[model samples]
Target chain A: MLIDTLITGLVAGGTYALVAMGLTIQFGISRIMNLAHGDTIIAACFASFVLFSVFGLSPILALMIVVPVGYVLSDAVYRIIMRPLVARAPNAGALEVDSILVTFGLLFVIQGVLLVAFGGNYTGYAFLNTPVDLFGTIVAANRLLALLLALVFGITLIFVLSRTRWGMTLRAVSIAPENAPLVGIDINRAARTAFALGGALAATAGVVVSMYQTFTATIGVIFTMKALIVVILGGKGSLTGALIGGLLLGLVETFVAAYIDPGLTLAATYAIFLLLLILRPTGFFGQAG
Target chain B: MNTTVAFILAAAALAGLAIAPLFLNAYGIGLLVGMTGYVVLASAWAMFSGPTRYVSLATVAFFGIGAYTVAVLSETLPYPLVLLCACAIGLTVALIVGLSTLRLAGIYFVIFTFGLAELIRQLVTWYEVNVTGTLGRYIFLPFEGIHIYWQLLALAAATLLLSWWINRSRLGLALRAVGDDEVVAAHAGINVSRAKLMLFALSATIITLVGAIQAPRWVYVEPAIVFNPTISFLTLIMALLGGATRLWGPALGAIPLFLLFEWLSANFPNYFSIILGVFFIGIVFFLPQGVLAKIEGLRRPARKAPPENKERSGAA
Candidate 1:
């Protein structure tokens, strides 16, 4: 039972870690909290659903199509909707407000499209439900696939972010945008690329998530909140922290549901979130100014 | 002389709305009731969020709490007492939450408030299942739809009046200063937290009362029904569309948008959210400051001030 629960928790945590990393990357450079991020996930889920149900393509194959679309669409969104707000916003706080409001509108647009295209229905498609053994523990193959994909995406991001010169420049932009321009780096282009990359990560998570779990049109906001919570828990601009925090959150939730009451999962999440805010407002990997 | 004219005009408008149910059919009354509810909700939300610039998504949480309070108590207590308890409970919760979380940056607070409804809904669901052995409550009050309308109308008037009064008071000045810059407000000897807490609690109380008043409309009280997270979004949009920075801005946004939504829902139910989304993006792109701001700007073109100048304060 312990092994089963731990495996389940880790699988869940892997997806969460990827989702949080996407948000942190976008927020790190772009400074725009994309409220519609989960909608992008939902859109990809629907797209993947269509690919499987109609074209009879595997979700793994669907990723190739959906991810690039996600990147391009998000880039278009930034160019059309967000660029003006970024330019007009006099300060970071004002930009935050404008982004929240605008993305809020964007959230509804995406949700509305999903709702109209596919009525408010719970959607799912089974890909690989066969059992797999990992360390003598039984787990579904789809879930394992999800875990592996999340790890690959997350690790690749960390590598690129840490090792490459371009990634370092992006990090520098996130860390000190004012200084980046002084160093002759084009901060605007870097921020846009980061935002689009974040959207692509969301698309990746969406495909991975839909492989195992059922989803609905209205469930996007809940995912947004969950990702936002993980981002706050992990700390700003810290991928590794998001990884640890996401896994911890998943374990905590699973344990609470298993030992205590299943209904207490959300309550436990809130309790820990509130406690963390009160105790360490900057988060685990955050620096105090 | 200006005050008297303004007061008389407001009074006449209130009187007109108060007697509206007598002339209108059930449909009109129902429409007005919803519009009035949003008016109060958006206005009350604007009272704190407008000047403070803290866009709170906890509106549904407090509103749901007030609804639950009434749902549990309306059977045992009188209507007025039930309302009072709901208000008191909402105020307490708001004070505690505001004290703890309002100090965070704008984005953090927005996310915190965004998650608050879901958290409260989960807790409520747990309590209902474990403690009460039920997930829903039936609120059968001795109140008519017209009664709900009148009460909401009175509340809307009160919200507007209070907002107007605050706009002229020292607290309003302090709140504006805080909204402009928290550090400067603190340096200027304004107790920033106190001002924010007071308004937060006050607005929360009104929102609670709205939930209490509208309980009969639902008839069945459940965490899912009462704690609809969309309420927060709707209220925020209405307030922003109207421009929270000004008195009556939310109402101006709420009235037209509410009517438009009603029409859209009726005409193209499936396309309702889609059209609404398009409308929201249009507003953010064009009338970012709100309809009132656009109107006021056009009305006084020689003022040489853009509507969003307030956002520029302390940004440098």
Candidate 2:
């Protein structure tokens, strides 16, 4: 039971980390707290569902199509919806407020579209339902595959971020936007790229989630809240923090539900989030604003 | 508006509300309750968020607290005392929350309050599950349709009156300064943090009472229903729509919105949310200063130009 719970927790946490990475990157670079990040994921989920049910395409193949579309759509969103706000904002603080409000509206729009298209019903499809053995514990094949895909995407992201020049440009833009331009980097292009990258991650997370979970059109806000928690817990603008924080949240929730009351898991998660925030205002590994 | 004219307008509105029950049917009075609810909430929200520029999403937290307080105490205490206790409890919670959270600035403050609200909600749910074995409590009160409308009307009047008084006071000046620049406000010798906390607590107290007044209407109270996240979003949007920065702005926004929503919800329920979303985005892009400013601008040509000396004195 314990081993099964551990694996389950890791699987859930891995998916959460995948989601939070998308939000952290957007917030870290473009500095827009995209409240609609979850809507992007939901849209991707519906996309994958359609590919599988209608076109008989596997999720892995759907990834190639959905991810690029997410990137392109997000880039367009930044241009059409966010550009005016960004142009008018007097400072980072104002941009954050404007972005939050705009994205909050975007969230409703996306949900409305999904509702009109799909109706408000829980939808999922069977994928790799066979049980597999991992460290002598039985787990669903779909869950294992989802975790594997998340790790591949997550590791590749970390490697590219740490070892590549493109990654260096993003980090520079994130850490010092004013200095990045002085160093000859185009801040607008880099921010646009970062926002797009976050969208790609949202698609990736959505594909992974649709594999093993049932979801409704209006449930996107739950994912946003959880991602927000992980982002704040891990520290904003810190991918590594999101990864570790997501994992910790999953494990804490699982362990608490197992040993303590089942209902206390949520309370435990936020209690720790609050305490950590009180102690480290910027988050556990968050940079100074 | 001048003090005399504003007073007359306010009194006339109150008188209309007082006599409205006689002419309106029960169904119409119910609709009025909905309108009053939003106006009170949006106005109360503007009282603090307008001046301080702190976008607090915790309205439902104190609202739920007030409701839960009444649900637990309505059987033991008098209705009036129960309402007072709800206010006291809401004020205490707001002070505690403001003291801890007001120190954080920008997005951190927004997220902290959001997290705290969710935390409170989840905790209440957990308690209900583990201790009570149920998720809801039935509330009983002597107040019915018209009585509920009257109480809500009184609440709205008190909210507008208090907002007007504070906007004219020295604290209002200090608050606007804090909104524009916290550092400048602090350096200029205003107790920025305390001023924010006071208003935050005050608005929270009113919101709590609103929840209490509303609880009997629900007849049943639960964390899911009372602590709904939608209420937070709806309140924020209404205030922003009318312009949170000005007195009477929320009411201006709330009245037309309430009417429109009533029509849309009844006719095209599926498209209601989509239109609401468009409304939010529209307000930000087109009317950032709010409808009041837009309306005020239309009559600009009718007013005579101020004397040349007025410009030198910084009067418009």
Candidate 3:
């Protein structure tokens, strides 16, 4: 039973890691909180739903279409909303507050658009509707598939960040944009690219999440909060931190739900979040700013 | 813009609002009551977050607690006492939260407050489900629409007065100093953390009172309804839109936006949110300082002229 729960938790955590990675990129590079991050996820889910239900396309195939769309949409959002705000900001610190307001507005706008496009109703997709025995525990095949895909995407992202010149450029910009410009790195281009990548990752996570569980337009905010918990727990802009944080959060939540009253799960998650903030605000892998 | 003139105009407006219920119909009174509620919320939120530069998303948490307090205790206690209890609860919670989070700056502070609200909402939902066996509590009050309207008006006036007082006080100066640069404020012998905590508690108290006063009008109090994130977003937007930095900015932001919200929700319920979303985006993009500030700037453009530029131009 414990192993089964652990496996389930890990699978759930995989999707969280995907979403948190997107957030970390945006936050690390641009310093924008991107409250609308989960809305992009929701939009992707809706897109996948339409493709599957209307066109008889697989959700995986939908990803090929959705990812590019996500990239463009997020790029547009950055250019239209965030770029102007950043230009007007007096300093990096002020950008945080301004982005919060602007992204919050963006969240509402996206939600409203989704609501107009698709009413407030739960939508889900089932793939590989079979339970497979892993060792002695039973697990859903689709969940395993999601886990595998998340791992692939996560590894690819890590590779791109560590082994690619573009990744180095993004990292340099994130760490020291002022210095990056001194070194001839295009800060604006790096920021725009990060946002686009973040958007794509968000959409991929959304697709996996919709397959795993039901979703609705209203759930975006909750998902955003959860992703934030993962981001903060792992350490503010650390990819490895987000990955580890996501898994740990998943395990804790799963264990709490399994052993204690399920109702306390969210409360417990937030309690740990608060305690972490009080004790070590930098998170496990984060360097104190 | 003189303090004395502003005070007189504020007093005249308050008097007008107080007497409005007599001449207005039920719908008009309802609209005014809702508008006043937003005014109180936005202004109270501005009191702490405006000068301190702390962008708090926890207004809904305090508001929810107050609404729930009234919902649970109104049957057993007097309305006035229940309101006071709500204030006390809000203050206590804010004090605890502010002490822990006030040390963090920028996005950390913002996230902490936002997380605190979400945590409280979830906890309340859990309690309602496991202990209460019901989603919400309903209160039957003996007050009419006019009484509620008067109470709302009084709350609005009180919030406005408190905000005005804060803007004029030493605390406000300390808060502004903290907002401008916390280290500088600390170096200047101001107890920065204490000022933040006090302002947070005070803001929470006023917001709680507004929630308590407005609870009975709804008759039904649910965690989901009272603790709705929309309240936080709307209050913040209204305060920002009207000019969060100014004393009367929130009121200025609330009246028009609330009216538009009411009109759209009533007439085009489906498209209302879309319009609001677009409006918010427009405001953020075009007028980050808020509508009132924009108007004020337009009205007195010469006030913003750089002294150096003026002297240089004169010499040229």
User: Could you tell me every candidate's TM-score relative to the true structure?
Assistant: 0.97, 0.94, 0.96
Q: How well does model 3 score by local distance difference test? A: 0.84
C-alpha DockQ of every model: 0.62, 0.38, 0.44
Q: Write the per-residue lDDT of candidate 2 for residues A8-59, one digit (tens) a residue.
A: 8888889889999999999999988898999899999999999999999899
- Writing each residue's lDDT as its tens digit, candidate 1 over B17-120 gives 89989999989999999999999999999999999988788999998988998888888998899999999999888877887777766666788888888888
In candidate 1, residue B58 scores what lDDT? 91
Judge candidate 3 at residue B215 and give its lDDT.
89
- Tell me the lDDT of model 2 at A45: 95
Cα lDDT of candidate 1 equals: 0.87
lDDT (0-100) at residue A24 of candidate 2? 97
Report the C-alpha lDDT of model 2 over B1-316, residue by residue, as the tens digit: 5989989988998999888888988889888888898899999999998877777878888888888889988999999999999999899989877876787775766766665566777888888787878888888788887887889999999999999999989999988888878888889999988998899999999999888888888898888788887677778888988888888899988888888888988998898778778888888777766788667766685786443211111100
Model 2 score (lDDT): 0.85
TM-score leader: 1
lDDT by residue (A194-261, candidate 1, tens digit) is: 99999999999899999999999988887888788888888977888787788888888888898898
lDDT of 3 by residue, A164-282 (tens): 98889999998888899998998988899898889999999988887778888878887788888888888888998988888788888888888887777778787888898899988
Off by over 4 Å in 1: B307-316
Using lDDT as the measure, what is the rank order of every candidate, best first? 1, 2, 3
